[model samples]
Target: MPIRVDLLALEPNVPGRACLTVKKWQGGEEQLEFSIQRNQDGFYLQDQKAWSNNPFWFKVSRFALAASGEALEAQVGPEVVDPLLEGGANSQFQIELREQNLGHADKGVVRPGVGLLPSTAGGQTRSTYGGVDLSAPVVPEPEAEIPELPELFLPVAEPEPEPTPAPAEPVYTPPPAPVKKSKKGLIALLIVVLLLLAAGIGYWFYQRTPAPAPTVAAPAPAATNAEACTLDSMNSVPELTFVQTCIKAAPDSAKLLEIINQAKASKHCGVAQRLYANRAQAGDPLIANAYAREYDPKYLKASECFPTADNATAAYWYETILAQDPNNAEAKQRFEELQK
Candidate 1:
């Protein structure tokens, strides 16, 4: 069965997804472009169907890393996927195709409606911001009125004559006395009017009052108790936090590169490889020499520990050396050797 390789590493990228590029090699020893995908529970290079092909060997292979993610200048967090269990070898973890064909044999069953891993903030915080509401407040337009039609003229009908009425007796009529206004009633009316007037004025002031100034949210404080990365902390796969600490501690420590290239940095290989890659790209002879000292197969195959090669980086450093001093025999020799 066809197999695909995934090399996980830090890079500058959009959060909430992994950025990956799938490369295909062709005739003339050219590596052609394949698919590039942003994985979220999806495999790179190949799809679920390709992975499902029966009779294929399944292996975790290596936790190979490239100087990606952080190299792209992405901020830390939304951790990298680690394939190892406690003290498990990234390379030693493997199995026959067996029942692994249709899906990941070792992967945990996270059902479709499964809940997210719990945290201090409960479930993941969703975005509070969104596109403008369809019903957002706006100045309302006046409703249109239909035009009135002119009334049509009509003829009036004649009325019939009324019959004579019988005689009726007269009734006495009484005159109404002058109305005397009570002093208490007048006072009460005046008080009510005054109260109403006062209330109206108060309402007017309240409406005219401006809304309180909008408050700005304060920035959260920096975390103090960040995980410390000692040589002892190299047991587990290095996460973004560990990578960040290594960066801040020694942005360019050749000694650290030596440890990492030799696999002495242990599983912190990703972090060390990243740091070394940065220096290797600097094109400085001293830096290159320091790096090449460890990347050389003589030190120990860097590819054995890390998924990538420092030898591939050697050409750049050697070329940089040649550019500075064309007559430099050692640089020329190494550059020529790498070319072969």
Candidate 2:
């Protein structure tokens, strides 16, 4: 039966000058104090007591005897086995070292007596012999041999001859003469020349044609002070100032037209009044009337300046105003009168 010992259990006992205290689990607690001291080459436990005849189980609570002592548990056999006595002179107990497979946090079991024994000197412990064996056998070599060669040979054969015949009279024929230069080449050359002449004439005509008198620069009109003053007034006023400015600056401008159209459509009375006043000052009675109708469709003053004598225009404006503001009794009456 092989003896097992936890190599990890002895980890605390590795460093030189360290003390370990082993506590036996069997009955009255017995403390085994061991000190790790440097021998000739390596470190070994020193000052350790020999085991008693009893089969005692012990654990190393702390090897360094530090505050948190490490535990190394072991089960010693019943025999008074002195490992130092077994291994020759000057040998120490080879604590049969093996890693503990202690599952998880549990400490693993160590079986002693299976490991190498230490050498002893005059009843004192000396050598440790727990190393593994690694010896193997060597193979022998074989002898070499030479190769052989072969011979060669040759052979011969015979030949035969034949007869010949006479030649016949020679025949000759002349090749056709080369052709003369034709009119086709002359015609092709004429076509090329004509094309070149036509191109040149086109270029000359193009050059001669004075590029239609470089468009006459239209004369800039004189600045109208009245228009400028109207613009200034339009800018100074709030609400409807944009519409007023548009009318003053560019009456026909689409944006301004849209703004006026929208104001009329929405029946914005204040905007319509401002628009009418601005357009009236701008000397556009037709536009003024159109805008005035947005506020007071029955406004006869605006009707009086109607662009069309048919009165249909005024009727349309009146109807539009009445359509937007049905409560406008004045617009309704004006519309009736215009119909008459």
Q: Could you tell me every candidate's TM-score relative to the true structure?
A: 0.31, 0.21
Q: Which candidate is the best by lDDT?
A: 1
Query: Candidate 2: minimum summed lDDT over ten consecutive residues — where?
Result: 105-114
What's the CA error at residue 171 for candidate 2, in Å? 14
lDDT of residue 223 for candidate 2: 37
Where model 1 places Cα greater than 4 Å from the true spot, the runs are 1-229, 232-238, 251-255, 258-267, 282-287, 293-313, 316-329
Cα lDDT of model 2 by residue, 1-340, tens digit: 1121222113222211112222222112123322221112333433243433332223333233224343334333212123222322112232322222322121111211112222221221211222111111234575533222122111121232232233365444343232123345556666876777677767766765676677788996633434422434343444333443344355453444455545545444344444444443334435534544533434433221222233443454454456466777866786677666
For residue 164, what is the lDDT in candidate 2? 28
Query: Candidate 2, which segments miss by more than 4 Å at Cα?
Result: 1-180, 203-207, 211-298, 301-313, 320-340
Candidate 1 per-residue lDDT, tens place, 1-340, comes to 1112222222322223232211121111121122222212233222222322233332322222335422111111222222211111212211111122333222111100001111121222321011011112245698754343334333333343453453476555353332133445556677876777677767777776799968989785632322234454445434434444444444345555554554443544445544444444434466556555554443434443444344434544565566577887877777667655
Provide the overall lDDT of each model, using Cα atoms, as 2-decimal numbers: 0.36, 0.35
